[model samples]
Target: MRRIVAALGASLLAACSTPPPPERGPAPAPAASPPAMAPAAPGALLQREAAVWRAARWDELPGWEADALQHAWPALLAGCARPAPGWEPSCASARALDSPDANRVRAWLQQRLQPWRVEAAAGRSDVRAEGLLTGYFEPQVQASRKRSAAYAVPLHTPPADLATRKPWYSRSEIERLPAAQAALRGREIAWLADPLELLMLQVQGSGRLRITEADGSVKTVRVAYAGSNDQPYRSVARWLVERGAFTLEQASWPAIRTWARANPAQVPELLASNPRYVFFREEPLPDPTIGPNGAQGVALTPGRSIAVDRRAVPYGTPVWIDSTEPQPWSPTPPPPRPLQRLVMAQDTGSAITGAPRADYFWGWGEGAEDFAGRMKQPLRMWVLWPLAHTPGDAKPISTR
Candidate 1:
């Protein structure tokens, strides 16, 4: 089965069967029809069911020429591996180039693709060109192959009767109920020393584990999202904020982890604040640099892969982002820098919807964690559609 790819980085969470709640940005006023004007030129108004794509010149994309297209080449090629409809010819041309030259890549893209400014379609509740941009990353945590006094927290596979149990068990009940425990008994894939890390794993839906086997051998592996207990997802960070543990603006993952450490006695209660429970399936991690496969069934390229609303932007399409880097987690951090760049629409999340919204993938490790944890910013997007295909030829109407 294809692996589940989901998340809304920082303090947000998503997974199969359980997606994070809709991300709410400023509620823009509904768009009004423009005053009578001359007919739009051919290829000007490219309309999809949920979005309006206005034909745009490449020059309109901020920082388009300045971007190092070579860095984005691999992600473009990766998306080509599972070419979306109308992307075959472009994919064929891309694979034939086989060169990583920045100039060549830039020229190829300019020659083969057209830019389209994305906006929420008229008649939508909130119609605007700007939208929310968040970030997500694969987490790396320590683990043990077998249960031990130190590594007592077990990350399990789906319960044997997960299917028949309807909503199965809440996170709290799974820990306290005998029936729930019995159903999950003997299903442990690995054990972690920290329950908060386990929660982190569950929230991200998938993560990397550096495991110590009984023989003292250490190796790394990936835990992919297998399934989830059917339950409503509540934000634990919000839970803390409501209880005055911290202000909502101070609810970064690092802050949460610090709170967990200082309040170890309440860790279980904190974990149970949200009722959702996620299950995992372990897989080999032969290459540490490559990321887990996204919903597109292709290994994601760090920094270049973005999770988008497939209803607005088709999978495999190249997107140009005009946003800023996340503000630092420090109290007196400097202002954010411009983060304009080229990215690919290779994945999706429950919370990621709308033409202009996106979730940037920051890869893995400590640095990635810091960046992704604070990456909620305003954004604008322009899709690079293949010149060979008209907007109508692309399938962004519905995934169903």
Candidate 2:
């Protein structure tokens, strides 16, 4: 019986191991490999360090047909004065343009330039087309040549030893230290009534001052960014939020001013939260219509000049922006009111980083201020390059 049981178990194991009958059908063909990407055309200027550069057509650009190209001519001319790499041909064509007609400018650009869409490189963790667009403008503020009962806040020029020092006196030190104050005693370019205005001027890096001289003669002049103390910048608004005094959403300039007015004793502490201080040099207003000098060392054109990351987009590069004027009251994003216009990358800011981020330069005065203060919008950008110019040996990979 034991022998029979063992034999039965062996038979069961053999049956379980037996293979099934094969199906009556032909085998499927081997999976094909994906098609290889096409190589870049000859003479393409590829920024290998950047995210990605994909060739694009003018027709593909949103609102291209509707943009007033003539309005950007002055800015184009200004950029030509300090042209970026491969911009010589385009700049020459721009310089030769005699007509200010929108159609003419549009035709000229269409003929000479190729638009390229900039996007995040493949395998990048953050891959997106949309970015943040903010606004900056030249502020027009009241000032005086000499400090008085009302105009107490002084705007100082950079000291001779500014370069020699690793980091100079901070906002609070300049106000409290006798030696620091002595270094800037005779270097007062102008004085303003509100300390916050002076702080804002420093933050903006440049502004137009409507001044009343000691002799009571009035004139408007520009105070351009001369130097800084080489210290890191700290935001007072962030400090306020960290201290639990106010939320981040309630840290607007007006809100801060209100807080300062209510707590006059803490004003100094509030101002001192920011360690960085900027110095300015007075400049003549050659063209009242044109804005102050930007980082590209040319006069910025209203609505056509932008500050971008130099690492991503070189200075003087033509950038097409697709953004909208922000609506502060709306909870939902407003319709894509296309600001799909040509703008020059002529400036940069500490806060303006990444490939797509930009700071649109709105000209001067209260209207500009209002626009700039309220402008933080979603944006997409395209860089326009000369079709005739291209990288010598490097092959560009098609992102599409």
Candidate 3:
């Protein structure tokens, strides 16, 4: 019945599956051990998550999203031993390197990356022309001497690119969606943001997204995308209803679109009002806890996917991203051979799981962040294990 809402959930649904198994039954009531530290509050949890994501200078550092996903996807995939359907239980399979999950995912992703006309006709997800904006992220670049962390640089674009706001949906991999590309042909979606492979629609660029800590220290972040490839307008309106925005009748796509268009300048205001929209991306473990690791993580140059083996690929491990998006996205040139790196798969979302299935971090820039939210396509990944395999790497924790 609904189109966009389904579109919105499509991405996230692929990453996180149903809530994780309830802690293997609560640790047998903790055996009356010494009292543990108080758990984090929802707000606090979110704040902590935000603070962790903000690298030295700019909030939307290139590989931050990748780092975040690197933190959580493995666990989720390890947990999702079997893939199921329906909202009740999360659906995912342990796609080990060269496993069936790997095969299916890679094959599907291969089709997705192809020309829109060929694959667009095949039902998959969807994309539409939108605006673009400059995305910025500071990595540790070289200087007079050795390596060091540096502030983010301005990866620029005009405001119009960050202003265009429409998600184009393709039909099923078996059938075309909305089949409106012809009407919407040649539409350029200058979409950008910190994508985690799913739900990229709502995170539209509005205001400055800053990560503030308890002590009042702040790291201001400029997101990249006008990311609206989220769930349908109705879904957002429904979420709004949950947050006391409107009545059921008003929670329709038409109503929401009209309202969104009417209050164009206020979209950020409306979006910010919904707490559901206020989400925190999580990073993988052994996070270096903000030490001066200056971890060299990978950069998600547009149209690319990085790999991670939770046990193997440590977070903040910067690696060069490799993709065949041809020119435009990738200037200079790609290596004669595939170049892979250990990026800081720092964050995690509800959807991203499986060993091969990766979270293409879209960083926190306005446009980039929005674009990252609604991305729900299967991605192929080749986790770059160390060139010189270590003893411990041999017996990697069973991601089965």
Candidate 4:
């Protein structure tokens, strides 16, 4: 009996190990490999942008650009025909848009943009704040040589800006608009940035008042305003853990928010212990004026961060950003490259609060939020600040 049982077990194991036969129907095809793609880099982005700028301004290209388009347009167009995914190479192959036509397009774009001057005030170079350093904004072009007074103290405790939308209590008019809640939630976004970035937003109010005495007396104690800033989620959480707000493992958003709320006054102190960063986002960004792969407005899709060599960086330039960084978001697409290179720098947030810094534009949703929260790495890039210009005064590189 023992010998028979041992033999039965071996036979069963063998039966299980045998490969299953293919189905009677046609066999399934093997999984195909994704198309080959160039690894995304800032340099690649700059090259594409430089090419277009040179090509688009074919007439104005002074040096090598004019030569490339004249003699090498054919090969270049061929190389660009099979433009990689998310990259729109249509501009490159715009049906032989000879010099005159290309120059026309270039001229059209230049005319569309308006340059405004930031009138300086004759006040002291340094102004006093409640405690920390702060800034006052003047968005409009003034007539006289002075700053104007159309400011509001951002609801945010840290210094805040007018354009920087906040979840206004709306309690005042909440009953009127039912759709307001959804609209507010829709705009909620998150991003990751460096800790040490300085983001100082301010308002032009004399000071806030408090009811210290009873009856008819009130106190006019000055309130110091702080910029609305975020500690890269990672950095902020780490600080929280060190300060006994949470344990290393217990560090989490909900936990952090709760602790932060409980010690509202301590929130700034907690965040300041680490490097603080300001937020940046594109304004008038209903649609992007530029993108990674030369897409036009509204068509501005998401892209990864690319390091630019500031010397060549240009506003509204297209670029391909590698989309490979994995987090609590998507299962990480095979290394992201050249999805788009963001050219605008006036967005909100801390890490990106510098001129030289590029806030990689990760489109909407939770994945972007997760990416922004956990992000904290240096990137390499190919900058596309315009190389050839007729006479455009570009914004200076951030002096952070």
Point to the candidate with the largest lDDT: 1
Tens digits of lDDT, candidate 2, 80-116:
7777665665676677677768999888777677777
Q: How does model 2 fare in lDDT?
A: 0.68
Global lDDT of each candidate: 0.74, 0.68, 0.26, 0.26
TM-scores, all models, native as reference: 0.85, 0.82, 0.27, 0.30
User: Which residue runs does candidate 3 get wrong by more than 4 Å?
Assistant: 1-344, 364-374, 390-400
Worst 10 residues of 3 by lDDT: 45-54
Order of models, best TM-score first: 1, 2, 4, 3
Give the alpha carbon lDDT tens digit for every residue of 332-363 in model 1: 97887999999998777655666677888888
Which stretches of model 1 miss by more than 4 angstroms?
1-43, 121-126, 329-333, 391-400
Model 2 off-target regions past 4 Å? 1-45, 48-51, 120-125, 242-251, 330-336, 391-400
lDDT rank order: 1, 2, 3, 4
Task: State in Å the error of residue 6, model 4.
Answer: 61
lDDT of 4: 0.26
- Model 4 vs. true fold: TM: 0.30
Candidate 1 lowest-lDDT run of ten: 1-10
Better of 3 and 4 by TM-score: 4
State which candidate has the highest TM-score: 1
- Please give, for residues 1-400, the per-residue lDDT of candidate 3 as tens digits: 0012322222222221111112221111111222232322221110111111101211212232233333333433322222111101111111332333434433322222111100111111331111111111111111111111331211122222222533333212101333433433333222222221112222221122333333546444322222222322323444555666445423333345566665677555444332222112122223221211011222223222222223423332222332211111123545433223223333223232223224443333334423332333333222211212221322222212
Q: In candidate 4, what are the lDDT values of residues 1-400, reduced to their tens digit?
A: 0000101111100010101111222222333222233222221111221111111222221231221122222322322333222212232323334563434433422332211111111122331111111111111110111112421111222223323545332322322455534433322121112111111111111112232233445333222222222222124555666677755433333455578667877765654443322222222322222221211111212332222222233323333221224233234535532221212221122222222223343333335323333333223222222222221423222212
